[model samples]
Target: MLNIVLYEPEIPANTGNIGRTCVATNTRLHLIEPLGFRLDEKSLKRAGMDYWKDLNVQTYIDYNDFLERNPGAKIYMATTKAQKVYTEVEYEPDCYIMFGKESAGIPEEILVHHKDTCVRIPMMGEIRSLNLGNSVAVVLYEALRQNEFAGMNLEGHLHELNWE
Candidate 1:
């Protein structure tokens, strides 16, 4: 299964939305430390609604801890500065897609270490960046597509849809 890592997320709603995506896609959600909002924030709860309980969310003290715990996994750093396009990379099931903070993005030190795997989503018309939640969704969908949309089944649970 794929892993979605967010480095120092600043918004509860974005994190919560990403959690929902992870739950639907059966991907593991890894959160790096120093989040702007608490896990129990109202905006997060509202955005994710009840699906938050079913989400497989993991927390890490920092990037180093995440690296230490999951060594050898290919980390694809998604950034605006990347020369390679996001779709060009051969994403693997063991790969982890890392997104930077909403305010400043991934630090240069970390970006430099994983320069070869760095990639950016395509944008046009002077758009500087995309919303964190939207960017996560886009990349997660792409990864899911590459993996044949694993764990997308919810056929019997249609009535349980939160529909937020």
Candidate 2:
């Protein structure tokens, strides 16, 4: 399973939606401390619907705490400052993909220390960044695709109907 790390995520809806994605993709979610909103917020529950409970989620007091628990784990930080594109690296199973908060991205110290593991999505438009949920989906799906969609269902749910 892949690990999705949200470092101080600000928005409830984004986290909730990401939780849903994790549950659907059989991925693990790790949240760093000082969250912007409460985990039980209505917005979060609404966005996640009933799938939030199924998500394999964990929380850390801080970056150091996370590091202490998962020592030697391959962590790829998603940041705009990275020179390498997300797809440039070969993603391995159980690798941790981390995204920062909406207002501020990952800390400079962490980025500098793990410079080789930092990556970014290519943005062609004038927009500064993509939505948190969208960004996660983009990178996570690419990783899943690279792994040939392991542990995921490929067939359409309504295939028996033959709608086409």
Candidate 3:
């Protein structure tokens, strides 16, 4: 099971979108506090729609609290400052992929210590970063793909017709 952590997320809509993605992918969503918007914000509910209730989500007081609760967890910090591309690492089944707030992103203090696990998505000239929700999807999907999408359905069929 993969985990998606949003560190100090400021945008309600982005959090909602991330929540929906997490549900679809059977991943857990963790939110680190100092949030800019309330969890009950209308925009979040609207973006998440009916999926919000089913989301496997949790809240943490801070980074320290998260680390204490999830000991020995292999976490991959997603940041533009990372030296390696996100695809370079061979993600494990239970790895945690954390994205920073839309504004400043994860503090350099944290990234400095976790240099080995830091990763970034490739971007073209002048673009500072990708949208928070989009970035999560990009990295999460890659990890899922590498794991052969375990325990996930790989095909679909029409209700009234057969492939034969």
Cα TM-score per model = 0.90, 0.94, 0.95
Q: What TM-score number comes out for model 2? A: 0.94
Clashes of 3: 0
Write the residue-wise lDDT of candidate 2 on 1-164 in tens digits. 99999999999999999999999999999999899998989999888889998989999999999999999999999999999999999899889999999998899988998899899999987777899999999999999999999978998765457558
Q: For residues 54-127, what per-residue lDDT tens digits would candidate 1 score against the true structure? A: 98888999999999999898999999989998888888987999999999999999999999999999999788
In model 2, the worst 10-residue window by lDDT is: 155-164
Off by more than 4 A, model 2: 157-164
Write down the lDDT that model 2 would get: 0.93
Q: What digit string (tens of lDDT, one per residue) describes model 3 on residues 21-81?
A: 9989999999999888999999998888889999999999999999999999999999999
What lDDT score belongs to each candidate, Candidate 1 first? 0.90, 0.93, 0.95
Those runs of model 1 whose alpha carbons end farther than 4 Å from true positions after fitting are 154-164
Error of 1 at 136 (Å): 0.7
Give me the candidate number with maximum lDDT.
3
Q: On lDDT, who's better, 2 or 3?
A: 3
Clashing pairs in 1: none
* lDDT for position 28 in model 3: 98
